[model samples]
Target: MPSYKLTYFDGRALGEPIRMILTYMGLEFEDNRIDMESWTALQKEIKWGRIPVLEIDGKEMYQSRAIMRYLAKQAKLAGDNDWEAYEIDCAAGTVGDLIDLYRSMWKLSDEKTKEEWEKKLLDEFIPSFMKNWDEQAKNTGFLANGKLSWADLYLHGWVETLEVLMGKEIVNEYPNLKLGREKVHATPGIKEWLAKRPKTVY
Candidate 1:
């Protein structure tokens, strides 16, 4: 196997899912955590000035989704064929949209502003995407293609992150989504990673 080193901030954020993917594949890689202070100086060295960069055999690659897709293929977490992969990608894209909207809510400081964002989150965003995912998950134990794919891992990690941010078990409202996520959590290496990985707010 080629040498792998993942560099990111000292929190879960975008980096955790990558870590989970690597761990799930049982690939031994250096988990390099850098502090915000150091990130300033190190930012110059990062190709995109964004992290979760995976260094493979000393060559660097960027983008979280790209890295996950490449690694998922290696781990057999991708779908069985092209159409299945496309379907999985679509599902993962939907979740990514939700995550961006959710993150925007954090920027609001006022109670009124936060409440408005929360309203949009619960009343609009959650109902649409979560309902769709829940329906699919009800029929299949995973999020996409009726099988465990990288999309399932992406959704599971983001759902757990949302729970931490919202300070409640929000996904429980969608039982199938919750159940599907539980299944992902129970995957062999993932379960151990969840148990032993560093705890972070993001």
Candidate 2:
């Protein structure tokens, strides 16, 4: 097995799913958490100046989704075939778009603006994602395919982040999505990780 080292901030954010994938695959890798004060000096050393850098056998790769997709393939959680993998990517990418929207809302300084944006998010953006995903989950009992895949992990993480931002139950209205997230958590490796992982606000 190739050696792996994942570097990110001390929060779950974009890093947790990668960690979960490693843990699920029973792969041992260094989980390096950087401090905010040290980031400036370390920024030059990091590829793309981004957190969640995955170092494999001393070689480095950036981008959280890329890292996850690569690891998912290694772990055989990506999908059964090329087409299945494409669907998996579609599901994960949709969740990524939702995450981007949530992050944009986080940047608003005015409470009124934030509230208005959030209203639109909850009313339209979030529901659109959930509606599509809920349908998919209903048919597959998973997010991408009829079996467990990396897309489920991405969705699980996305929902967790959304809950933190929305400050309420966001998945309740979508039963399939809610159950899909629960199923991801119930997977043995993920279940164990969640039980012992450090608690964080995000």
Candidate 3:
């Protein structure tokens, strides 16, 4: 078995899905959480000066989504076939779009403007995405292939982040999405990991 070592910040923002994928695969890995001081010291050696880098058998791999997809294939969670993989990618891409949109709010300098952007994100943008995803969940509980896939884990991680950003549980308002998130949380390996994983503010 390849030795796995994940290097990331102490939080879950962009690293949780990759961690979830590895944990769900029953893979033992070094959860190498680092602080800002450590990151600053290590930045010179890191590719692109960013993290959530996975060292597979000592070969480094960067990019969180790329790592998740690679591990998903090994976990048998990518999809059963090509078209299904395409669907999973579509969902993952949409989730990435939402994450980027949320993160962009932090770039605004003006407090009032940032507040306005956040309000719109919480009100219009999130609901729009939720409505569509809720429908998708209603049809296919797993979000893509009517079975568990990495896309579902990806969505679950995003939803967890959204809850932290919103300061409350919003998934309950979207029943199907709530159910779908529950399904992902209930998967055996994932359930165990959630129970044991270190708690973070996200």
| Alpha-carbon lDDT, every model | 0.85, 0.84, 0.86
C-alpha RMSD in Å of predicted model 3 compared with the true structure: 1.3
lDDT of 2 by residue, 1-202 (tens): 8999988887777888888888888878898888888888889877678788888998998888998998898889998899999999998999899889988987999999999999989899998988998899895568877788888887786577678868878887888887877787888877888898777777
Number of clashes recorded per candidate: 0, 0, 0
The residue ranges of model 1 lying beyond 4 angstroms of the native Cα positions read 106-115
- TM-score for all models, in order of appearance: 0.90, 0.90, 0.95
The CA lDDT at 4 in model 1 is 93
Tens digits of per-residue lDDT, candidate 3, 153-187, equal 88887678778977977788988888888888898
Full-model lDDT, candidate 1: 0.85
Clashing pairs in 2: none
Model 1: per-residue Cα lDDT over 73-152, one tens digit each:
98988888899899888888888899889988879889899999998887888789888998888766688878899888
